[model samples]
Target chain A: MDREALFQQIKKKNSYLCIGLDTDLEKIPQHLRSTADPIFEFNKQIIDATHEYCVAYKPNIAFYEALGPKGWESLQKTMDYIPKGLFTIADAKRGDIGNTSALYARTFFEYFNFDSVTVAPYMGEDSVKPFLYKDKWVILLAHTSNPGSSDFQLIESVVTGRKLYEEVLLKSQRWATPDQLMYVVGATQAEKMESIRAQAPEHFFLVPGIGAQGGDLKMVSQYGMNAQCGLLVNSARAIIYASNGQDFAQRARQEAVNVRDEMARHLQDYYK
Target chain B: MDREALFQQIKKKNSYLCIGLDTDLEKIPQHLRSTADPIFEFNKQIIDATHEYCVAYKPNIAFYEALGPKGWESLQKTMDYIPKGLFTIADAKRGDIGNTSALYARTFFEYFNFDSVTVAPYMGEDSVKPFLYKDKWVILLAHTSNPGSSDFQLIESVVTGRKLYEEVLLKSQRWATPDQLMYVVGATQAEKMESIRAQAPEHFFLVPGIGAQGGDLKMVSQYGMNAQCGLLVNSARAIIYASNGQDFAQRARQEAVNVRDEMARHLQDYYK
Candidate 1:
């Protein structure tokens, strides 16, 4: 999906919410387990109930991969089921050397049909440059929401007195415009959002760390949202696993409604 | 495998060669294309011919993933077929937030039974620490073999006047011991290998770019190689895709033998 289309969805829905389909076998409703594929069944119901409240859905690939070949089949089913126009993200943090990266690009963009895939930037421009095919987005990791993110991303670069993420934001502009590229700015670091936006104002920020990670939605929106409403605030367990019983899908819809209502207010209050 | 087991494999084989199984359906010999699973068939033949010459097999995950679900099945078959004691690496550069990363660790290490999986360090310590479970190894990306390695890795850090890769090597040492952790030092940057070894003396280095990428065996061995012959020199295209004709597996065996012979000499010359 293009930037204009994505922003249009955000406005039309009045929410920049991206529900994370981080479904696990042990975490799903027990009644669904006897079905042909429980993971797909769970996701199908959750997407059906909550798709209207969110602008996108991100299926964390690791969750599917843990199930082996059958898991990938379930993932394909879920991807196929999600309604079009709701942007899809393969939340797989994949990046490799140039030649190998092309196969990954094909796996997600061509085979899986995701609109974007999160990528690690430690290997630099060549590793990430392959994902910049026409229209498909490359969401580069800047300052992630994890504690380990400080391990390398927070280090200040001597070449330029900027932190590694600042350099990533500043240097990666040469690769693509805001239309083709985005950045993963963990919502936990909302204070840093102002500074992060200062570095790359136009680029969309796929912000995780909101619900389970203790990040305040208001603060993140206050600091990060742009004129285009450049934020994809993701909530996984807080939305999808809101309940584990037969009412799991109903409870999930309720949670998504509450979160999207808050998000919609933020879009109206902050986005110009 | 543990550190002693890996070192023993190198000593027993007299080769630190890691054969990269970047199997492609279109690239395999025409005769094998008619098989039910040509990729696995090609890998079975290659492993049969060259397992004696190499200590490890690194299957570039992107190759199989490009084919969708069946590709993963072929990968599971190839993984199951490799003879015991030969180290297996899921050449899937995968890492994510803490919980998500745990799933990736389970996917490659527990589910697929790979000895180790390469991880990108952009996300930091927590992203890497989970992969250190049991005896499974975390081959951290230190200095890659691509031109883009210079983009972020070679950038000098202002915090302590160190390069980005240096901080990665130094900080990551605190996360796991040498038994569980390894580093990826690209063969293309042989000059930097000496400094890299200084930061990480005991840890094994997974060196790629040896044959096809024009990295010299002699130069990489000179700067790398600890007392344990601490290097797994990988040659992908130069060994696996040595020929595209009917004698493909035979030619691949010859290529592996040639690379492993040179690697064996390096081990002999450096080790006490």
Candidate 2:
């Protein structure tokens, strides 16, 4: 989906939350375990419960893949369960040689029909460019929240004097237009949000780590929001696995609603 | 596997070649099409015929992922078919947030039982550190051969004032010792092998783009070799689908033998 349509949805729902469906079989409610496919069953109910409160759903590929063949089936079913208007992300951090990456793009975009996929910039342009079609979004990894993030991503280059992640944000901008490219800047690193916004003010940032990861929502919105209200704050475990009892889906919706309500406050300040 | 064990296999077989099992269903031999599972049947034959000549088998995950559930079943069977002593790789370009990335590490290392997996370091150290464990390796993407690599990977960073890829190599070294980490430096970009070797020096490099991508094997060997002869040069289509007829496995063996002979010369130089 295009940016304008995505923007319209955010405005319509009064939220910028993207609920992450990092569903795992062992973690879901025991009541759903007896189903033929517990992962997909859990996901179907969660999507149904939380659809209205969030603008998007991100299904991390690893959780599904760990289940082997059955996991992939669950991923495909979950993608179909998500409604058309809401954005869907195949959170498969894929990047490879050009030809191989093209096939990956085909798998997520054509066969599975995801609106976007997260990409790793370490492979350079050819690996990421193949994923960018007419309206498909390529969310490049910029500054991450993990402690080890300081190891490589924060390194200062000897030639240009910019940190490595900053160069990734600056250089990757040349490959695709702002409409087609987005950056992944973790919500935990709220301090860097202002510098990131200044560098790529026109692009959207897919910010993960709000609820469970302890990233402050207000701080992220204050520094990262642009003229377009360009941010998608994702909260995975804090929502989907909110409860392990029969009321799991109901509890998930409550958690999603809580995040959405907080996001509404951010949107009000965002517009002002 | 440890570098000493890998080197022992290279010495015993007199080959440094790693055959890439990028098995695509449409590309399998026609006779195999009648088998219960064409993709798995094709992989089994290739592994049976070429197991003695090659020390490793690299399966590109996207090929298996595209077929959905059935394809994944084929991938597991293919992994099972390879001889126990031979090195195995899941060419899954995975990198994500720290906690989520830890799950991916478990998926491949525990569930899939791959000796190593490819990683994209754009998400920084946290995305990569979770993959390093006892006896398992995380091969990070370094310098790829694609046309768009110059856009971000080769750009000059203003902070460190060096090219972006160099910073990744230099900074990521601190996270893991050489044995636990490897880097993927494309064979097509052989000219830069000198610099890569200088920076990485001790780590093994998973070199793609050798056969089908038209990279010169001789030039790559010259500049990319390390003290331990640390390079896993892969050839995918040029070996696995060497012939589309019924004699595909036999042809695949012949192609692998040819690369093995060439690799012998490179290893010989290392011993010298």
Candidate 3:
């Protein structure tokens, strides 16, 4: 989907929430384990329960990959099951050399048909450029939510005096427009969101670290929202694992509703 | 595999030549494309022909991933076909948050049973730590082979006056010992190999960009060799695509032999 279509979805739903499908076989309800494809089954119910409340679904590829070839099947099934109009982000942080990266672009965009794929900026321009297809998106990693984000992303550059992530934010913009490019700025770092938003005002930011990761929805919305509701605040564990019982999907819907309702209020108050 | 075991294999073969199985269905001989599981068939023949000459086989994961679930099957079969006592590197330059990185670690080290997986150091220590299993390895990206490697990698840090790649080399050393850690010092950057070797004295460097990318094996061997002959120089296209006809396997073996002979001479001249 293009930038306007995504913004329309957020506006129509009155929500900018993106539910993350970081589904683990071991973490799903015990009864579902008896099913043939437990991961897909779990994701199907969760999507059915929460699809109305959210605008996008971001599947963390590692969860499916750990299961081997069978995992890829589950992932493909999950992708097929997600309803079309809503956005899809393969939260697969993939980047490599030029030719190898093109294969990855084909993997996520052509084979699996994701709207976007998260890419690491460490490999620089050519590694990231292949994924910048017309309507498809490349959500480059800027300020990550993980503790380790500080390790390298914060290092000051002697020439530009910009921190590593800032350099990533600046240099990457030259390669693609906001229409096909976004940034993965973790909600955990809400304090930096204002400046980051100021720097790249037009681009969307896929914000993770809400709910289970201790990121405040109010704070993130206050500092991060844009004219088009330029934020995809993701909550994975808090929504999907709301309850491990038979009412798991129902409980997930309740959690998503709560987050979405809050997002609606933030949309009213913050979104220009 | 541990450092001593890898060194033993290198000494036994008198070579540290790593064959990259970047097998593409479109690029393989037309005859092989007609067969069932052609990727695996081609890889099987290549392994059969060249296993004795090379000490390590590095499979670029994107080639398999682009083909979807079937591609994964071909990779598994190819892994099963490679002979015992040779090191395997999953050139799947992957890294993410701690929990996610753990899943990727399981995918490669446990599920795929690779000796090591190339990791991008963009995510910091925790993202890399989970892959440091006993007898397993993490070949971290220090300076890459591509032209874009100059973009962020060579950015000088204000505090330490060290480059970004230099910071990666220094800071990452604190996370793991030389036993399980290695660096990817690209062959295209042979001029920097001597300084890199000095900074990372004991750790092995997985050198790519040898043949098709125009890196000099002799220069790389001269500057990058260590006490344990710390280098696994990789040549993919130059060796694997030596012929496109039915003689592909035979010709591939000849190319492997030529590279291995050159590596043996380097070992004889440079071994401490």
Name the 10 consecutive residues with the lowest summed lDDT in model 1 chain B: B208-217
Give the per-residue lDDT of model 3 (tens digit) for B132-190.
89999999999987878887998999999999999999999999999999999887656
Q: Considering lDDT, where higher is better, how would the candidates rank from best to worst?
A: 3, 1, 2
Mark the 10 consecutive residues where model 1 chain A has the least summed lDDT: A208-217
| Angstrom error at residue A122, model 2 | 1.2
Please list all clashing residue pairs in model 1, or write none if there are none: A148-B124, A157-B158, A158-B156, A158-B157, A158-B158
- Cα lDDT listed for each candidate: 0.88, 0.84, 0.90
Model 2 misplaced stretches (Cα beyond 4 Å): A157-161, A188-191, A212-215, B155-163, B188-191, B212-215
lDDT of 2 by residue, A90-185 (tens): 888787757688888988999889989888877677777888898899988888776767756776765667777888899888888889998889
| lDDT tens digits by residue: candidate 1, B1-272 | 89999999999999988999999987888999999999999999999999999999999999988988899899999999999999999899886767788999988888889999999888888778889888899999998878888889988877688888888899899989999999989876566888888889999999887663234778888898888888898888887788999899999999888777777677777874
> DockQ numbers for every candidate?
0.85, 0.58, 0.85
For every model in order, the TM-score on chain A comes to: 0.97, 0.97, 0.97
List ranges where model 1 is wrong by over 4 Å. Answer: A212-215, B212-215
Q: What is the TM-score of each predicted model, taking all chains together?
A: 0.97, 0.93, 0.98
Which candidate comes out best when scored by TM-score? 3
Q: What is residue A256's positional error in candidate 2, in angstroms?
A: 1.8
